[model samples]
Target chain A: MPIQAITPDYHGEVRDRLENFHGNQLVYVGWDRHLLFCSAVAFPLAPDTRFAQLRDEAMAGVFGLHPEWAQVDWGRVSWLLDGEPFEPMLDRPLNEQGIGHKSLLRMQTPDLKGFQSAGV
Target chain B: MAAKKLNIKDKYRLLTRDLDWEFSYQDRKEAFPYEEFEGIKITDWSKWEDPFRLTMDAYWKYQAEKEKKLYAIFDAFAQNNGHLNISDPRYANALKIFLTGVSPLEYQAFQGFAHTGRQFGGVGARIACQMQSIDELRHVQTQIHAMSHYNKFFDGFQDWSHMHDRVWYLSVPKSFFDDARSAGPFEYLVAISFSFEYVLTNLLFVPFMSGAAYNGDMATVTFGFSAQSDEARHMTLGLEVIKFLLEQHEDNVPIVQKWIDKWFWRGTRLLSIVAMMMDYMLPNKVMSWKEAWEVYFEEAGGSLFKDLARYGIRMPKYAETTEKEKEHVSHQAWWIFYNYGQAAGFHTWIPTDKELDWLSEKYPETFDKYYRPRWELARQMEAEGKRFYNPGLPQLCNCCQIPMGFTEMDDPTQIAYRQTVYNGERYHFCSDGCHDIFVDEPEKYVQSWLPVHQIFQGNCGGPGVEDVLRDYYRMNVGADNLDIKGSPDEQRWNAWKGVA
Candidate 1:
């Protein structure tokens, strides 16, 4: 399984500084004690790349912040893709038509069995 | 090339050109991630209402106006001896951290939106992302201009862009945001846009303004307050996301529920610091962690989560624990700052007896037992004029990255421990997820170069508090917070706020 990442188009030596952290390390930044964001720089050859997967999984995490992806230019974006560079869709950005919003991940498949609600 | 200037309304029309395209590669099902969670039924994505209704034009128009207002104030603050207008510089330390750690994140949000604007599938989402993409960039630029005054007064700030990369505590936020940016578009929205903006924005902005109001930092307060007004709109976007997702498909319910859980925990864990800052850090104060929790999470998110329960999302998984743990996390983060502020980029001092009484009232259950006995001991040490730093590295939580102040849920006081053998050496964590991340790849997380440990290693200024504070973080002998003047950003605040 290859690493999938969406590096944003940001400048400044800050990104360069992240690259300076040795191989495969988690770095955190905060506003006072509140953690504003987090990421781990990992090498692919390193085993058990769940962080890689979790990182990819975070894409759907910001659903409301960005409900549509087609309006902006995606070409300029850059992020570590599995420690190398691999865009989600190399030729086609993920936001184009034909991708139904419902077609995303299988969110709640109606278990009717497993999960239990509290106030019931 | 300067993207040709067009009115924001016309700007949308220009960008909306050649609007039709075909999706041929993968089935629609394989594309978006959170289609179904519990039982959400989505009849329409078009129904999603951006409360901002912000086309690029109105966005820029209002945005430009906002900046114009900021600049008028900015020029005056800089010219009118505004730095002298404040109560003390201790108040500015909070602003310094904001400039370093948070302002950069605003820019990061802008970048996330730029990527999201291009990656999302719907026109509404794309436009919204583009709007946010632009708004966040404006925020970053404005905040930097506002706080640049401190460049003349503070030390560590000058190198923050450099420090955010290599610094230890910074990894918490860097990894958190990058986690969202690398994930699918919807998850990014849920994590960064929704949970952070809608549910928790007030937690961040409210205190900063109050802190400013408390301190004589009127300019800082004014800018922060003006900016937070925009946050109301962002929060709407967040609320809209959860609502729209739950309404979309039954399948979306469980998925959105999972997101609510994952994001809620992630955001809450990160905000432990905010809890501390709000309750303890400011020289003056506002509501306590308990009070803010009651209003924001319990009243707002607490109820919001229940409403979503109608859609089967249930409150965030960590809700029960978070509500309980606030007692501890709030005290711990502040104590860390209060105890270790010498090594950090900021300053901390022993809480006055008055402040301690407030903490006991605010935190109630935990403060007297778990934290204060030790704080009193420290106060004794300081009275004896002897401060204490542990001789060696105390264990660090692999996930949250604080020295493992965490314990099992049932017994909040027990030190939670999980360990693994890495390179034939033992590593530790307070939770399973952190242990998993560390064990999965030790090379990635090890050598976090925590600020306290750096001083111990002699990698920072020799060994003493003075040396470390002055050399590394750019503090001086007399410049520490305790020695500062005029009511710790509180007395002047009363003058400015008109409330005694």
Candidate 2:
């Protein structure tokens, strides 16, 4: 339903527009079933930043603390982009792969069922 | 013959209801412009019942008496060194959360009730709102005075008003009140008075006040006792408002129901902070968050909805979801705080062994299976000279403004992520309730000053987390945040107790 308001044309200014981030867009990454990290970690990344740089450089710092981080094979890990299954071209920039601002990327490790299968 | 003396009820009617003059020179629609915009139909203003009958003179006298008693207790608590009498220094962290997150909300309630008091067409509701407005003002003042003694010795209590506007976690309570205040007058009453004060106020007050009494904090407990009568009046006003709206016109039922649904969900999400305080922060336990929900919400709220059934009102949407969520929300909330301790205003710690055992016993079904191992790992990491803190900022829900840390109730392990694209931008929510609220009023939520997004956009003070925490949030840095185990608060408590 449309909002019941005093005025008919009640348009609010969106505060977190992509332009507000100084050329970088917000991207969220969640390791599926890994409750240890609590929520998805949000990162500000340029559209031209390659997927490999995100995978190798940024993700290691966020997900490396888990005991199972080292054992997971990136090639075999399945991925979901904004809730739909997707395959990212590793060498390509994020925008080319259709990952936009505030897009969520969920990575699932099939065999590594999070530390004793408890999801932590 | 002398004029007959007036009784309390006659005096109340003479002073309050009789004082409202009819609009002889101006249009009634012009006088109350916002009444029709929200789609509520009021057939007659005269149908509104006076919720509380206290006239101005009586109201002032009653409040002044409560103030005298309350301030006397506050003075004695300070002179007696009450800070030293708490069950544990960790109990102080709960007070920090209350002072920063909850006290400002009382001020917002004051502003909301004051504005609504002027906008209402019914004089009875207007007077009721006016009295509640003053009560809210007094509540905030008394709350701050009660907690002022803690500010001298505590780290996080120093810059609370500044931090409430800038901090990441404090935005949860801020946005809740902001959403209600910006709404129309009738919606504001249903959102705050009925949904929050009537339905969920017990979940907040009972635990915090009882916890204060159990933990030996006389100042907070006295303030709680002083505010008790006012809260009862506010709650009675809430019930009267709902019943009056429902009985006045049949068209008003669906609108009021929608407000109840939206605000009840918002109230539960905001109370996630209190859930953590009850289960983990208190040195002496009151009851588990799950148990409190059963007694206060399921039992008490169940009876309330049953009474409203004749008006075609049903239980609030997502109440079933809230029932399943109570077991896990406290654990999940504390875990998020523990992970981001460095950025928070209050200190966090791994729960002591006795506390862990207590949690295990309280949550028999899920604790050992899911949460116990995580705490064990944190404890092991601490012992091995490696204290873990999440380096990255958490993604926040667009509606609630809380970090999207809550997980699916059934799965318990998978994070519950919900999103929708509106006007070419993606918005996220922690649950369906929050998502539905945004979908209903995307314009209102779109303007949210989400702290994480602001930090990443360079709109917060600086680029780094520490810069934002120290400069933007005005936190005392090393003194205010991080683990409580080795904190200056703990050390001071130990010294006061003469422990080497």
DockQ of each: 0.02, 0.81
> In model 1, what lDDT does residue B100 have?
61
Look at candidate 1 and tell me the lDDT of residue A74.
Answer: 40
Query: What's the TM-score of every candidate structure?
Result: 0.67, 0.98
DockQ of 1: 0.02
Candidate 2 regions exceeding 4 Å error are: B1-6
Query: Please, what is the whole-model Cα lDDT of each candidate in the order they appear?
Result: 0.57, 0.92
TM-score of chain A of 2: 0.95
Model 1 root mean square deviation, Cα atoms: 17.4
Q: What DockQ number belongs to candidate 2? A: 0.81
Give the best candidate by DockQ.
Answer: 2
**Is model 1 an incorrect, acceptable, medium or high docking prediction?**
incorrect
Report fnat in order of the candidates: 0.01, 0.83
Cα deviation at B478, candidate 1, in Å, is 10
Task: State the lDDT of candidate 2 residue by residue for B1-500, as single tens digits.
Answer: 86598887788789899979978999988999988888889888888888887898899999999999999999999999999999999999999999999999999999999999999888888999999999999999999999999987877899888988889999999999999999999999999999999999999999999999999999999999999999999999999999999998899988999999999999999999999999999999999998999999999999999999999999999999998998899999999999999999999999989999999999999889989988987887788888889888899999999999998888899899999999989999999999999999888888999999998888887868999999999998999999997899989888999987
